[model samples]
Target chain A: MSDIVFTNVARNFRRDGKEFPALRDINLSVRDKEFLAIVGPSGCGKTTCLRMAAGLEFPTSGTVAVGGVRVTRPGPDRAVVFQQFALFPWKTVAENIGFGLVANGVAAAERARRVADVLKLMNLAGYESAFPHQLSGGMQQRVAIARAYVLDPQVLLMDEPFGALDAQTRVVMQEELVRLARVNPRTVLFITHAVEEAVYLADRVVVMSRRPGTIREIIDVASVRAADSWDRFEKIEDVMDQASFVHLRTHIWRLLREQQAPDDH
Target chain B: MSRRTVVGIATLLAVAGLWYLLTAATGWVGSARFPNPAEFGTAVKQIVTGGYAGARIHEHVLQSCKLVAMGFLVAVSVGLPLGLLMGWNRRAEALINPVFLIIRPIPPLAWIPLAIVWLGLGDGAKIMVIFFAAFVPSVINTHAGIRNIEPFLIEAARMLGVRGPRFVFGVLLPAAAPLIFTGLRLSLQASWTTLVAAELVGALLGLGYVLNAAAQDIFPAMILTGMVFVALSGAASTWLLGRLEQRVTRWRTA
Candidate 1:
């Protein structure tokens, strides 16, 4: 079971010789093939939580296990898609996607085949040789997502991957994401501040509290999808319009809003 | 040609015409102070055929270019890797930075006396001075380039399981390359200028040596000829470097 288990996780950041907690007691068990979106207000340490799963970070005091193995450093088992669409600027679209395969010592012919297949899967067939700067924000993020997915990792950690795109592009990406997840499911920890996004795509939504973040609420969004999956609504707009979607989105929004610091209000 | 190139060419032609009117055509500036194109042409022919000091004009140009190439290549070989080490490892930076801080403030010309004392008045001393000139920028800019990179890119690579030497070679080197090239360009300019100044006091051959001899002899035409060759050679090296930089970083939008 390619599950991610975060046991009593806490993390602190030091700035100017001052120590401040960023997350505390983040106990999340993201099940295999589950789409778990962690939603909260900005500075809620949602991204930090995702980074720990990617093995790019460590908790000050807890065990983060991927497929039952304790994460110490980044390994081939997990892939991350960052909010900045951090594609290697020197590498082409195809090169970026195949970077993991290369790192794994996958031979050239096989690497090309898998990269080409994933390119088609992501609807990025014709833009292989193009650079990241040449592509629009949506297309660049698609490449980033494609890069992570091509790894065939046990877990995919995304830190607000769609947060940089325009509203229209973000919705379209969400739709594409839903379609892809249905076909090739993997345990995914997606972090976002968008309530509709957290509600529209996740099987379960974990709402986080303000800094020194904690799991304020764990929401089951898939109940409304008794027989039909969220992918049933071909368009993100259609999913956003569902009565159940609106209720869940509003509930998560209210939960997140309450967690915002009082001083800010 | 594009509008920009065409406009640039026209501006150069306009300046040349103004120079011609001032010295060659009107004789208003006086040829003694500023040689006419014809007088400059005569000087160029004399240097080309008769030779200057101990060598021909082309030989002097070749010598200067060789000195620059030697100094620049050595600096790049040593400085590039040193910069990478410092940029990649904090411990390396801590170890190297103090010495680098002490060495960095001294001008390349300041080393002339020491270079002569250590290596003597020859190609070796001149090369040493030029090496110091090129070395500083190569290190500083390379370090800056690596530090300036977005930290997220490193996270992305690490997540993809790229670390250790692979991370340094595959990720850091390429990411910092454009800025490294920027440093190389500065180093190139430094090498040229430093070589000239060093050669002025110590060299038997080179453009600077030619210029020094010309000034002493009060041969305005030869001085003009020497200055033109120096400018021409500097432009040539910079142009070649620009092409290489473009090819390496072609992924960037112009």
Candidate 2:
């Protein structure tokens, strides 16, 4: 069964007496355990797409479904890792991770056990008692990831989850996410503006056109994973040379540049 | 000693020295009005020994503390929930804000006459006056604290399956706690100040009553002692509130 499905989804936002369309005709589906990255320029509705999937926002038209069920509101079955590392500032690392479980009426002992496991998985074992403000930005994001993961959601919606970190930290977080995806096999709909991030983490990278965003192309990265002993950085040229990757990147870049151009109208 | 402790002691000594200097410098001009430090100390001793107007200073201090405590409790109990509702619901804010706006500008002292008329110049009137003094800032600060919380935090909580009253208690309250405590502390100070003011009219046993009686008797030393007791109580209340704030916010610092 498809883990997530978006059928002709549209999102329109109203501001200052103007109706701005954020997403238009978004039609996509992800199979079970698929790692799909949605890539687009800023304001290209990538985050809005993830928010819609996570049920934080409603589509102006059509439906967003997960595991064959339509989404109307946020639930514990689908967890979200926000871009801003939205860890509760007043809560300890452990408390933040356990929040979802607590909200769902899990026993204290069970909640603590799950929190402890994620803390170890995220390499944050000794810092469980530390407040979010006390942690570094990278560490805070780790807490956010752990919080989402501890809920054992059927699908994970990550909205540029590593965008706030330093470049080195971002790479490390990306690699960590890749490792996490490998172990858990959760259907993850990741969103990012960075082409490299989308290419590195996704099983298939879905490139999006600039605002009033529509899917430009979907490039399967399965071949890159199939290659043995390949260095991601070293094989960048080879990866880009793939007909699908080339076509998708070119189409997306052209769309973005056209949107940025100065127009008299 | 810590720098804060040293500075605090130095300030106290300087203030005491100034009081002594002022009384001594002004003695010839109004000996009945201003008392030197030694005379004030003598009056304190007399009060302790039941030699000053046959009323013990301890009774006045106790009465003032009781009134302040009762008024502070009443203010916090009413203000916090009102503030939280106003902050959490836009409709509640719209409905209640006008009332608070009209009432807030009038000083608590202005409520004294009404309180006395309603409650008959008793403990009820005194407590009501103090409550009126403290309630506005407490409610205003609590509302500000809740309103100032980042909207992203609320969205994050909601997305985590925390909604309704559970969300308010589990997420919103903790997030707004520090600022709410600040409001509570300010209200406590207000209550302490208003307690003395309330006692000024027809109160039989408070510090203010004793001070007024001392002034009428031209007993400058007794007046100074009464003023010192009032200052001490205010300082003590402030110190207690600081400790409470530290305890409440310790988790955020962890």
Candidate 1: segments with Cα more than 4 A from true spot: A227-231
- DockQ scores of the candidates: 0.74, 0.70
**Global lDDT of model 2:** 0.84
Model number with the top lDDT? 1
- A-chain TM-score of every model: 0.96, 0.88
- Residue-by-residue lDDT tens digits, candidate 2, B113-200: 9998999988999999999988988899899989998877887898789977889888887889888888888898898788877888
Fraction of native A-B contacts kept, per candidate: 0.83, 0.73
Q: Encode model 2's per-residue lDDT on A1-265: one tens digit a residue.
A: 5399999999999999999998999999987899999887677898888888888899999999999999999887888888888888878888899888888899999888888899999999999889999889999999999999999988988988888899888877877887777677799999887776777678888878777898987887766556632335443456556665666566656655665525512
DockQ of 1: 0.74
Candidate 2, residue B89: how far the Cα is off, in Å: 0.9
Query: For this target, which candidate reaches the highest TM-score against the unseen true structure?
Result: 1
Q: Return the TM-score for each candidate structure.
A: 0.97, 0.91
